[model samples]
Target chain A: MKRYGEFNALNGASFQTGEDARVVALLGPSGGGKSTLLRVLGGLLVPEEGSVLVNGVALPKDPEGALEALRQNGFVFQGYNLFPHLTALQNVTLPLMVVHGQSEQAAQQRGQELLTRLGLFDHLHKRPAELSGGQQQRAAIARALAPKPRLLLLDEPTSALDPVMTGEVLDVIRELAQEGQQIVLATHEISFARQVADWVVFLANGTVQESSTSVKFFYDPMSSLAKEYLTALTKYR
Target chain B: MPNSLTRRLIWTFVLIAGASLLLYATFASVHYPWNWSNAWSYRFQFLWGWGTTLAISLGASIVSILVGFGLMVGRRSPTTPLRLFCHGTVELLRGSPLLVQLLLGYYILANRLNINDPILVGMILLGFFEGAYLAEIFRGAVESIGASQREAAKAVGFNKVQMYRHVIIPQAIRRALPGTTGQLVSLIKDSSLLSVIGIEELVQKVRIMNSSSYTALEGYLPLAAAYLIVTLPLSWYASRLERRFAFET
Candidate 1:
């Protein structure tokens, strides 16, 4: 449980996941603990009375130990917080060289290769502000992928973009999902979740409301709340 | 010449002529004795004092930057006690008058601590006084970066040092440049107060010359000009840096 004085942000929110689920969608309403749960699972936050284990290694309470465990995952934030001062290539190259201990030449090679694959080859030398929202998000994804993490965590990656920009980012994420990247993303885009998610976890009010295969959750939701949420979400989009 | 260049040259000439007229008026109005030869002979002495002033300011600026960075990191620390301590120290230093601090450092602390080097004491005192304000600048600059940046840093598996060195601090320094240079300009002027302890800096030299030759106009004008010489270039360089960093944003 994570508490802010008296209020709880995560109250006994528990679930289990097999490593085989290539894409896990954390679908929920705003302030429904989707982001908090993603933070916990990524070892960015340690709950007061629970354990977060990824790849069979339990995240320790100490910060350094938690960081060691967190290294196995790459995270993309809602704002697509690329380093504004660095070029797109430098933003991606820095982690590979600094965190993963790759030589500059090797890191640059991998960074260039990833940016090219993301269709940012023409804009590799541009800074974040120089790129469009979609390009920036794509660069952020390349930055996360540079270290070859075992898992990827995305917190509302397309929330800051317009529809056209959103489509640009989601297409890249769809490709990654198809290539079998173990990814988990918190999102309000129910339709995108339906199209790409393998396992769906519906969260609300700081608890897991329902968990099921994507087909079952979308085609036949067990919980009434989940069904209502799906209906309400689809109505808006 | 281009029209803009010609206009600038004309303005410069007019400014020089206006300043000369003002100087002539001040010389006429002042009743103090003007021993122009004595002041001229002491020009080398004033140059030496200017050099000392530069050295002290340089030393103080370096010390403040290093110590200020430490205070900034301490203030941002997640530990409560450490953060509180850093905050208290900054508050105390910034709250008190710098002249008082210098007096305490020279009169009481020097005797108790047995550190007799006046210049070293002056530099340390000025360094800390400026550091308190610089710490605030650094804290503000660091905080100005979005919260998501830190989260992104952590998500990338960067250790604390790596995150600051490669990701955060460089940006903070760039963002804080204008404010940092402003503080440095203040530090340069504030070094004049150290003359109270017989350090013989530029202002002190001017004081000695004014008392002996009784030429307040002759003595003080050169001192003002010397300070302008130091600060004007610094201000220009700061603006240049601001432009260089603008390419990023």
Candidate 2:
């Protein structure tokens, strides 16, 4: 449980991903603890109680251990959170050289390759503010993927973008998913989640409402909250 | 139509002319004999004093920034005792008047320590007095960086020192520049207070000249101009730095 003052952001929330799951989509309404759970799972935030085990390794209670766990997973925030002072290439390369102990030449080569693959080749020298929302999010993804993290966690990566931009960013994530990169993303995009996710974890009121394979969760949701949520979300379409 | 440059020049000329007229009227009404020659004879003395003031300001500026950074770090330290000590020092320095601090620092503290140089005591006291204000400025600048940026740095595996060196300090410096420059300008003005300790800085020299020439206006006008010469360029350079570091949000 994580207490943010009087409000409980995550209260006794528990869920697990399948061993072979490639893309686990966390689905919930706004302020339903999806983001909190993702942060905790990535070890960016330590819970007030209980423990998180990533690949059978318990997330340590100490800050040093928590940081070590964080290093193994790449987290993409909803706002992109790109370093404004740095160019797109520099943002990715700086951490690689400084933290990961890569040489300048190697970091530059890897940074350029990742950015190019994300279709940001022409805008490599542009700062975060100079790029569109979609482009910034794509650059953030590239930065996260630069260190070859064991697992990637995204917290509503496209929520701040318009529909057109959202589609473009989602396309990039779909490609990564197809490439067999393990990813866990919290998202409001119902159709994209159904299409891309192998596992689904539906949360509401700071607890998991349903946890199952994407097929079972989407087609035959057992919980009333999950069924109601799906109907409410799909009704607009 | 006049472009911005032409308009700016016209306004500048008008303002200067207006200021000249105001000064002329004020001086003409005084009906006192205007004799700049008496003060002018001490040109060498004025020059020496100006140099001393410049040196003191420069030294104090460096010392204040270093001490301020150290105090800011201490204030943010995890240890309770160090944090409280730093907090108490900042409060004590900021609460008391600079004049009292300088007098007491020199008479009581320096006297006991067997430090004879008034100039050295003045510089140290002035630097520490300004450092308290600078510590707050630096702390605010560092805190203004968003939580997400720190998180991003951590997720990328940057340890505490690496995060500060690579990410936090670079951004914090940009935010701190304007305030720091303002503090430096204040530091320069505050150096005048060192005149009380017989440092023979610009103000002290002007006072000595005023006493000999018995001409307050003639002695002090050039003194005011000298201060503006130093401060105006500093402010302009600070604005240039602000523009250079500016980036779109």
Candidate 3:
């Protein structure tokens, strides 16, 4: 469990992804430990208790092990924390050159290709603040994808965007999902999660309420908490 | 409508003219004898003193920045003893007056160590004095970076050194510029205090000139002008750097 001060952000939270699942979505209300769980899965945070096993290998608590796990995964934050001092192209290339030890020419080529694919070619030279919200988030995604991570962890990636910008970012993720990218997403967009996620893990009160296939969870939720949450979200739909 | 450049020039001219008028009036009211010839004879001495002051300021500025950066890193180190040592040093330097520190450093500390060079001791003391302030400025600048920035870097699999080198330092440098430049200006002015330790800098030369010429106004007015000449360009250059480093946000 992960405790922030006196509050337990994740207490006895456990679930396993399906064998054939390409995308796993964590669905819950605000402050229900979705973000904290995603962070733990990515090895960005170490829990005070419990073990995390990814791909049948237990995550070691040592710093070196955590670093190795992080290297294999890419995390996109809700706020799109792109380095403000760097342009979009530099933001993507800097990590590759500095952390991954790629040469300048190779890093630049990879950064340019990823950014162009994300529809950020025209804004590659612009800094984060100069770009629109959708553009900045796309740049952040391109930076995440530049390293060719085995698994991508995204925490509410479009929570800060307007409807149009939200649609733009979601479309990019959907395309990635369609390309058979392994992704674990925590989000509040019910419809978008329904469309993209192969498996669903519902969390509440820092505990896993239900873990099932997306078809089963959406059409016939077994847990009462999951039923209440789905009804509350679908009340107006 | 007036363009911005014309308006700025107009305001500059008015302010300068006003300041000149104020100085003239203040001097006229004194009704003192104006004998610049006696002080003018010491031009070479004054030039030498000014050059020395400039050299000391430049050396001290570089030394202080290096010390400050080291101290800031120490303060953030995981080792408790090093962090406390750095903290205590900053407090001691910032708590006491520079005059007292110089006297103690030269007369007591240097004597015990058997180092007789007054200029070197004085420069070191001045640099340490300013370094305490700069340490705090750097710490504040580094802390001002959001937690998300660090997390993002960590998510990209950056080690501590790589994170700081690739991500944190660039942003911190930009944030620290204004405060760092302000501290540097203060450093230049504070160099005059080193005259207490017989550095023979500008202020010390002015004292010698005044004692001989018995013309305080003539001797001291130029001393003030000499300091302004150095500090004004520094501040102007600082503003230019501020503009160049300014990101959109």
| Among all candidates shown, the one with the greatest lDDT | 3
Better of 2 and 3 by DockQ: 3
List, residue by residue over A1-237, the lDDT tens digit for candidate 2.
Answer: 988889999997887888888899999888899999998888888999888876787889798888877888888999999999999999999988887889999999999999999999999999999999999999999999999988899999999999999999999999999998999999999999999999999999999988999999999999998888889999979
Ranked candidates, highest lDDT first = 3, 2, 1
What C-alpha RMSD separates each model from the true structure? 2.6, 1.9, 1.4
Q: What's the TM-score of each model vs. the native?
A: 0.92, 0.95, 0.97
| Winner by TM-score between candidate 2 and candidate 1 | 2
lDDT tens digits, residue span B180-223, model 2: 99999999999999987779999999999999988888878899
DockQ of 2: 0.79
Residue pairs in collision within model 2:
none
lDDT by residue for model 1 over A57-163, one digit each (tens)?
Answer: 66898887888878878999888889888999999998888888899999999999999999999999999989999999999999988888788999999999999
| Model 3 C-alpha lDDT per residue in residues A1-237, reported as the tens digit of each score | 999999999997988878999899999999999999999988999888998997788888899888988888888999999989899999999889887889999999999999999998899899999999999999999988899988899999999999999999999999999999999999989999999999999999999999999999999999898989989998988
**What ranges in model 3 sit over 4 Å off?**
B1-3
lDDT string, candidate 1, B45-116, tens digits: 899999999999999999999878889999999999999999999999999999899998899998699988
Q: Local distance difference test, per candidate?
A: 0.89, 0.92, 0.92
Docking class of 3: high
Q: Give, for candidate 2 chain A, the lowest lDDT window spanning 10 residues.
A: A49-58
In angstroms, the error of model 1 at B172 is: 1.3
True contacts reproduced, candidate 1 = 0.87
The TM-score of predicted model 1 comes to: 0.92
Worst 10 residues of 2 chain B by lDDT: B212-221
